[model samples]
Every structure is written in structure tokens, then in C-alpha cells.
Target: MRRAPIIAVVLALAVPSLARADIQPHKAIYDLVDEDGAATGGRVEYEILGNACDGWAVLQKIDIPKAGARVVTTNASWEAADGSAMRFHETTERDGQTVSRFRGQAASGSNGFAVFTDGEGGESFGQLPQGTLLPTLQTKTLLTQAKRDRSVLSSNKVFLGTSSEGALPLEITSVLSPRASTPGDHPELDGQPSWNVTSSFYEAGGRPDTGPDYTVRSIQFGNGVVQSMEITREGATARARLRSLDLYEVVECNR
Candidate 1:
């Protein structure tokens, strides 16, 4: 799953007509609840740093306390300034034991893109389709298209690699619409215009409706802040609410 839920999903929002300063660097916290309230004691934290001229840093941590299958997942990744390459590492711990870890990098290639991994369990190689996009660029594309007059955007390919197999391309289909907002603690976001973005993920090279691997629906604001998110898979859904938000001062790049 996109443990970063928000991280694996939302990134930068630099449209052609916008200035780079429009990029946002912030830290956010979300509390999670599964359908039926069957699971409690769950939380997700996300933070983003850097800019398009100096690469981007993202970190997400998810903790779920189940009776016996308690698990915590941490996802960290760095995308190159131009979105041409990226390095990612993920660690999953269960019941106090480090269960899995993956470290890898993907770069643009003559054909498309290539991925090499040497993690705790094994070593592997993977290839991304020619149109495949790294996470941040993928999100930028989502926001760009969402702002258009169209209501639905489909067939966008993105590589959201979470493990050694992270390079596999997933087709994305999104439905978007304008939304209203309410007053909130953070004035930067309070009463801001928002959009309802619902995206479905499907395996590449197949029919999307056969059954999407998963779907993500989020409340995205004009400034690119994802106020809340929900991820659904196998007919079950987990929801996360934005409980905290901190926008960082934009740092000028010396490069």
C-alpha cells in the first residue's frame, strides 16, 4: 500500500504558468480510521522538503496497532530536481522485528527508465515504460490535468515503487470536481478552495475496470495541500483526516 498515503500520492504543484516559489514544503499529521471502526490506534505522518531546482525529500510513517499483527512502515524517497531520477528506501517492522527493507534507484534511460535494487531480501532489476513518471512529477501531472475543464483524466502511467518491485508501472484514472471548504485552525488553508480528486490504480497493459488494484480519493486545496485522504482496496476503506499542518518558509536554492 502507499504507506505515505499522502506522500505516495500528493507532491509538488508547479504548472507551466506558475512560478517555482509556488512549491510548498511542509509537515502534516493525519489520524486514521478503518471502516466499521474495527481498528483503532492508527496514525500517519508526512513531511516534504526541497524544490524543483534542488531535488525533493519526502518521508512518511504509518503505525497501526493491531492486537497481534501490529506493524509500522516508513517510506523515504528523494527525487532529482528535474524529476529525471530518484532514490527510494522503505523499511517495514512488525512486532518489534525488522521484517523487510528495500533500497533502490531509478533513472531515465535510452529506452525508458531502469531500476536497480539491492535490499535485505534480494537483488532485482526492473524496467519502467517510456511514459512512466516518478512520484512528484506524477502528482504534478495530476494537478495540472485536474485543473482543466475536463472532469476525468485517464491512462496516466506512474511508477510508485514501494519495494524492490516498485518500478512496475501502474495506470491511473482520475475524476475531479470543485469543492467548498470550511474555516480551520491553519489560516493558510482555512476557507481555501478545494477539489475532490478520486483516482484509481490499475495494472499496466490490461483493462482498468476488470478491478483496480486500489483507489485513492482526497480533498486537495488550491495550494496543493491534501486536507484529507481515503484509500480503498478489496472492498475495505481506511480514512485519514488532516489534524495538523505546518508550512515551511520557502528556501532559495543556491544552485
Candidate 2:
């Protein structure tokens, strides 16, 4: 137990055209189960590399199986082009050694963003208030505020410098559902047009009866693929489907 910062829920992403729509780099694979479904042996792979005119890269990996044979890995990465400027790193290993590590950088400070950190708890500096949003620009500002306020959107205050024992403050809540179609074993997500999201991660000023510490229910699509997800904490729940997906080939920026 005790390892629940909710894993940052592994971030989210995609739409294109309009200059490749903020972001759309892909490579995903998920299959983890718990909450009675079993199979907690572990699995999660993530990738979102480059685009949005140049600047985006994220890699994630998590494997679990600890006890006899031992195997626990958790890796993370992020490199930003402009999402308010960012650079982060993370690590955790077990059978292969290396226990913990973290590195950080955040910019865009006129009065709102400026954070710098160094691993295993060493250096630190923080201050994020004005419009604070980092972590792939807060998932592209929660899919453009859940597509222009279709319903419930407008609650953000994020900054996860991948933990240097510092930069911690997450409070995001975006909900918008009622336009769906696409889930027939994927089939390249059929026609698109999806939304049945439900994100909730709190701790920044946490209230609302101290409920959310982690929550994510997904469907996303509409370009930013999410396919399916269900992550809860405390009550214990874990699910992530969308076995495989790949789409990354868009580089046309000459302006």
C-alpha cells in the first residue's frame, strides 16, 4: 500500500488539422485489472511523441509483480514544446535496483509559473497561481474545456513536476458526456465523436468532503483518443483498455 498519489493517472491526450490540434502523438497499450477483476500482475504502457508544431513527448511504463521473483518498475518522462514550458523525469525500479528519482523544470512566469526541482528531495522553488496548468497543458486544457462547456468544465490547478518532493498540487475536474458512439472493438474508433469523461483529482485546496484523490473514467476520442479507462482510488478500482493504438506521423510546420 501507500503509493497512491494516484500515479497522476498517467495524463491524457488528440484531434488534428488546426495545426494538428494541440497534440496527437500516439502509442498506447493498457491492460491492468483490479477491484475484483483480478490480474493485478500489472501492465501499462504509454507514449505520445512530438507534434503541435513541435514540442511534446511523454513516455510512461509501469510493471508490477513484487514478492518472490520481484519486478517493480515505474518510469515516466515529459518534454514540452510550449505547454507553458516543461521538462520532467521520474524513475522507480526494484528488481533492477534504483529506487526513486525525479527531476523537474517549469517555466512561463510573469506572475504564475516558475518551478525548479531536483531529485530525491534536494533543491526546490515553487510558485504557481496565475492560470496554473502544466502536464501537457493540463491535457490541452481538458479538451478545450470539454468542447466549449457542453457541461461541467472549469476547474483546473495542476502542476505535477513529476515530484521532486515538491511541486504537488492537483485539482482537476472535467465532466462532459452525452455524445457517444464508438466502441465496437475500436476499429480505429469508428466515427469519432466521443465524450464520456469524468476526471477528478484533488488535493490543491481539497474540499467537497475530501472525496477525490483520484478518479478517471474515460471515453474521450473526438480526436484525442482515450478509448476506455476507469481508475479510482481508496475504493480501489483499476481498468484501462485499448490494447493497442498507434498514430504518429504528422510533421508539417513551416510558418
> Residue by residue across 135-246, what tens digits does model 1's lDDT show?
6676666555666653546567776656422557677777778776666535678755567888877765657658777778877765556777777877877787777889
The list of candidate 2 runs beyond 4 A from truth reads 1-29, 32-42, 45-61, 64-91, 94-96, 103-121, 124-130, 134-144, 147-159, 163-180, 185-225, 228-255
Clashing pairs in 2: 14-223, 14-224
lDDT for each residue of candidate 2 in 113-200, tens digit (9 for 90 to 100): 5454434466666677777766666666655655666555657776766542255557777677656563464777676556777877
TM-score: model 1 vs. ground truth: 0.83
After superposition, which runs of candidate 1 have C-alpha atoms over 4 Å from their true positions?
1-19, 35-39, 67-69, 116-118, 148-152, 184-186, 204-206, 253-255
C-alpha-based local distance difference test score of model 1: 0.65
Score each candidate by Cα lDDT: 0.65, 0.61
- Ten-residue segment with the worst summed lDDT in candidate 2? 11-20
- What number of backbone clashes does candidate 2 have, counting pairs of residues 3 or more apart or in separate chains? 2
User: Which ten-residue region of model 1 has the weakest summed lDDT?
Assistant: 10-19
